[model samples]
Target: LWSSIIKSKNKTYYLGYFWDKETAAQVVRIKRLELHGEFANHG
Candidate 1:
């Protein structure tokens, strides 16, 4: 299995463990939105 990971401020976060890269990328997008907050980019 392959894993998706994101690191920030000396911390490591997992997006997910997936069988393929495509799924991992999708998970990363969703997780990024959650971590960054949905309204963060709203003007």
Candidate 2:
């Protein structure tokens, strides 16, 4: 469910700039992964 939400948000950014979809998606995915990793490591 949360994954879907993230994907949708990325899609919105992608729609704003066609060439940035991949980069934006990668950035978003990486940020989310980093956040999850930090929470898992400390919490």
Candidate 3:
């Protein structure tokens, strides 16, 4: 699992902090799927 929390200027941003290869891969896969879905829906 990847997770990160950053606070700056009262704004918080969470960044990837992958713990393992599998987790990183899963994140990438999910992101790709989401992008694909968005493109399919819009195009």
Taken over the whole model, the C-alpha lDDT of each candidate is 0.74, 0.43, 0.54
Q: Write the per-residue lDDT of candidate 3 for residues 1-38, one digit (tens) a residue.
A: 55644444476655487877676656555654554555
User: Which tens-of-lDDT digit does each residue in 1-43 have in candidate 1?
Assistant: 8799976558899766999888887777776677777643312
State every prediction's TM-score relative to the real structure.
Answer: 0.64, 0.40, 0.46
User: In lDDT terms, which candidate is top?
Assistant: 1
lDDT (0-100) at residue 34 of candidate 2? 55
Report the number of backbone clashes for model 1.
0
Q: 1-43, model 2: which lDDT tens digit per residue?
A: 0121233334432213234556655556665565565553321
Ranking by TM-score: 1, 3, 2
Report the Cα lDDT for candidate 3.
0.54
Candidate 1, residue 37: lDDT: 71
What value of lDDT does candidate 1 attain over all alpha carbons? 0.74
In model 3, pairs of residues that clash are none
Write the number of the candidate with greater lDDT, choosing between 2 and 3.
3
Report the error of model 1 at residue 33, Å: 0.5
Ranked by lDDT from best down, the candidates are: 1, 3, 2
